[model samples]
Target: MSVTGAITSGDASLLPGKRDEDWRWTDLRGLIRQIPAASPQGAAWAWESPLAQAGGEVVDVVNGRGRSDLDVPAGGEALVAWRFLSTDGAGAHNAELWVSVGEGGKLTLVESYEGRGAGYLANTTVNIRLAKGAKVERIVFADDHAEGVSVVDASVELAPEAAYAQTVLTHGARRQRIETRVAHPGAGAELRLDGAYLLEGQHNADLTTVVEHLGVDGTTSQLTKGVVRDQSRGVFQGRIVVAEGADRTDARMGHHALILSDRAEIDAKPELLIFADDVQCAHGNTIGALDEDALFYAQQRGMPAEVARALLTHAFVGEVIDRIEHETVREAAAGWAGQRLEL
Candidate 1:
């Protein structure tokens, strides 16, 4: 399969604007300018993922184009499609995966991104709907090359008493962003978002989330943590909005980042917009270097300096991993983090 297309003029317009309130801090134009024209490349490389045969709905987007080899679950259905067009110096390639969970159904959807060409622009969108009392666990892994620009847009709607959980893991990329918007339109909905990013070199990764409490007695929680080394940069912006009619809404948002080098950077913003007087909402964000006191304590106890640093870094990210309800996934994620932090 060859994944290449024309270069659309004014494609930058399709990309998010910096003037937009949500992307004010990020330079979208500058980033898009760095991407070269897309070209079709031969599909000579392949990846084997445990998620490939996990049995629900599987969608693969390789190098800004969609793949047609997909298998739906026995009792599930999927809508798969692709969109490609050119604008100017840039282009837009979107692979959409939509899944509908039947009543009291249990499903797992996994979307993975892997790019081949360097300096190519890629954008993807995923939409999911869970029926009443249904349960869905979605996992997104962005293991793109170190020289590609990628963005993922995910929107989910939860039915009454439905349960939804998502885990996002990203490695280093030239520039990467993942945005998730979740709405609890039905009463007593439960939603949780957990994410982790491992960035090094000059790579950049951002995870932004907006969760809305629109129904009475709904609950939502989000925990995002990241580790940036060298001159890499990471950003986490999360907002929880509670409607006036959502009297019994409960929501919490937390983000933390660990800066490993003097040149590394992290920008964190956690906001809560509440309109219901009876709702309980809170948000917290923290960005700083490793804890010197704890480091000194470990060093005094005869631990090597490098070993102490790794221990502290692990503890910082462990809080986010602990929130993963699935034991197997949580252990695998933790192991991946441990190997990445090896010093």
Candidate 2:
């Protein structure tokens, strides 16, 4: 539940830090000596989302304040664009959102975190519940200020034959983490988790996830990639657990990253713990710099040095962007990443 986020309880000691297994790489408890005051309410937070004009009902939360409930009835379908925007005040705030889907329901949830100003702390938690035969596709875009700190936590519960697919794209901030925990009932239910983070300057981004198999016949596939430059840092931690009776469970996890600058850093840990038989599980992790051979090959083709590097980086992160299920949102996400990649 606590994923290195600033403690809204105003008790700095409650913040998660290096002592927590899931948060050892991120030390929020030591980062904040005092919880900041709540951000001012009713501020002039006005902005328009690019996806809003395309389609979908717009649910906006400014400075951690606003409407936060989205529910779909049985056999129904919906499209929603959930946006969280912060103010210029260097304060602390938190928001909670609940999403429920009935049997046979489908939802496309496009979430975004747009933070403004510097030296602010924010936390957000989203709880999702899916009935039998339900489906949910979530796409997140997070662009936080270089000096801001934030954490986003998600807890998911799925019924039999349910499917939850999510892809997160973020240009991290001073201390930004997105943590997700999923309970897979393992009755033909499925899960797909993917992420891509591009951080520059002194920014930091952490993507942590845990998946637990409660029954039989569940599957999970996860892939995460990142590119850090200019002394930035990126973290990825994924753990999958299969219970004793969770048979026929198939799961795979992979994380890869690129370090463009000598001072940049990336920490990755992928683990799979199986207590059941007849299950297939594996994990892979890699951290390195740009492929010099590929860079040389690109330069041989007459591409400028900077242009070639940018092109390669863009293509590297493109795999994650291309996995977005929605067409319009996919294009929008590509453009957003393209601008950041300077491609």
Candidate 3:
């Protein structure tokens, strides 16, 4: 199939944009002039990662193809690191990733997307399935090269007694959107989704997620934070649903953003749909600038205004970046966040 045919629902030639409520802020159709064709097989490639682990399995997907090699462990634990890279110039690159965890299995998966481009577009789709009694911790990071545009869509399903947690960190690009859809169908299942974005320059970033609770005693929690500067824009749209019979469901969603420049903008929408009587669901959103009082206090202690601002901004985003379990990954994210702030 052609790259466009594989990524789009019906018409590969058309792209979603402001006409669609889900894409009101980031319009791929208007922003992207042309979608690049898939690179031919056998294109020379090389990948380098800063979060390399000693015993972890690493899978690299370049352009649009990769090795889907994964062994199911009988028991104990497994770690897989999936890396996505695109250097296809002005053309569009497409990639797909799938992960499955068996019953009574424990897995830690890390997926990161980075590209080197002058004006290329990259699209990726990820799907994950968790069996009964399975537990998983997944981390995702997106940092596109200069003037790159990327769109990532992910879906996850959980079985009875399964647990899943995911964290995402994005430094933004010319345009980027990371959308996730999750379903909890098994009783007593739990899900945690958290993300943070550090945007600067003219970059644009959007994080959209929809979660459904379809079983009894299912729980979900989502928290997202963003820091925007210059003329950049950031968006977060989160929705949670509790089915009619999904009793004892507990879900909460929150999004907070910090706007550093008067020209910067942040848009957030958090929604909840509850049909069950015995359910506890709540959501909140907040957008504001840095605390002037805190900045003043830091300056009083003999710190420059710029230093104080950078320090405060770092602390704002550290809450989410620190949640990454892997030490290397967590530290690398922190470093990236700090560097983005020019601290």
The prediction achieving the highest lDDT against the true structure is 2
Per-residue alpha-carbon lDDT of candidate 3 for residues 1-343, written as tens digits (9 for 90 to 100): 2224534433344777788889889887777655655454434245445666345787878776786545445355888888777764535667787778888888888888877666767788888888888888888878787588788888899999988989988888888889899989848898989999988889889999999899899899888999998999999999998999999898989898999999999999899998899999999999999999999999999999999999998998888877777677777778777777788
lDDT of 3: 0.81
Give lDDT tens digits, candidate 2, residues 1-343.
Answer: 3533435557787788888878888888878788888788745355455687677688888888898899999999999988887778858888889999999999999988887888788899999999999999999999888888889999999999999999999999989999999999999999999999999998999999999998999999998999999989999999999999999999999898999999999998888889999899999898888889999999999999999999899999899888888888889888888899888
Query: Model 3: how far is 33 from its true place, Å?
Result: 3.5
- Over the stretch 116-146, how does candidate 1's per-residue lDDT look in tens digits? 5566666666677788887777666676667
Rank order (by lDDT, best first): 2, 3, 1
Model 3 has a clash total of: 1
Q: How far is each candidate from the true structure, as Cα RMSD in Å? A: 5.0, 1.7, 2.5
* Angstrom error at residue 341, model 2: 0.8
TM-score computed on alpha carbons, candidate 3: 0.92
lDDT of 3 at 126: 83
Candidate 2: where is the Cα deviation over 4 Å? 1-7, 44-49
